[model samples]
Target: MATADPYGPVHTEGNAVPPLDPDLAGALDDLAGIHPGIDLIRDGIRHLALDRHTPDTTQTLLATLAGSSGADAITAIGHLIARLANADHNPALRGLPLDTQKQAQRHGEQAAFHLNDPTLHQPASEASAAITGT
Candidate 1:
């Protein structure tokens, strides 16, 4: 079924960490559920110190979320990360050559096309195909 690996390799060699999206989603879910001093997490993220801690910061956030009762917080985190992932301000992604970004976007779009199965939505397809006796 080739399920997507949400925490797969980050495209950097030899590092054993999952992608950033999972981490962000996990952290946000925990914070909102616990109602912790999310401001602190925000402050830490704003300072770019997260890069310094490498895996520690991410590990901690994920651990916190794991322990919290707000298990659904991961969904909230995804919402936050989707905003970041789509934002033009992130030079980390936007700095890439336009063609490179376009290629990645195309990959996503193509996957969506298959998953959506446009054939099912065809305007004038034979509705009896499901009951074909021919």
Candidate 2:
């Protein structure tokens, strides 16, 4: 079976990372279309100011998730949390400065409120009660 590259290219030619598989790139592009925060993740990576070349880190994240084992909804929620909530800690965005991390988190938190649905996320009080089984 042809497994996807769990991680993208091992080496790059002077910051020129290899092109992603067309299908994978397409899928990532589709995600960007629907999820505005996905691009925020992309922009956050670009803003990292690293000397080395960076590939599409958001796409890299999704591609990596493609190889992991998990329920679809769980994986997706986790992906959002990583990209939006814990942007700095995620593999692609790890080691970023504190301000940047906070910025990403703020955007994420705002997204949660703006996109909130009772069915999707319970109120904070209810969540706390559920967790403590109170």
Candidate No. with top lDDT? 2
lDDT tens digits, residue span 40-133, model 1: 6655554443353434444444433322222323434533444444325345678778887666555545544443343423311222222232
Clashing pairs in 1: 29-73
Cα RMSD of all models vs. native, in order, equals: 20.3, 16.9
Worst 10 residues of 1 by lDDT: 122-131
> Which candidate comes out best when scored by TM-score?
2
Tens-place lDDT digits, model 2, residues 1-134: 98878887656675454455677556556667556777875444434323233334433333333322242233455556546566555655457887887777777766544444333323433433444455
Error (Å) of candidate 2 at residue 51 is 48
Off by over 4 Å in 1: 1-92, 118-134
The 0-to-1 C-alpha lDDT of every candidate, in the order given, reads 0.46, 0.50
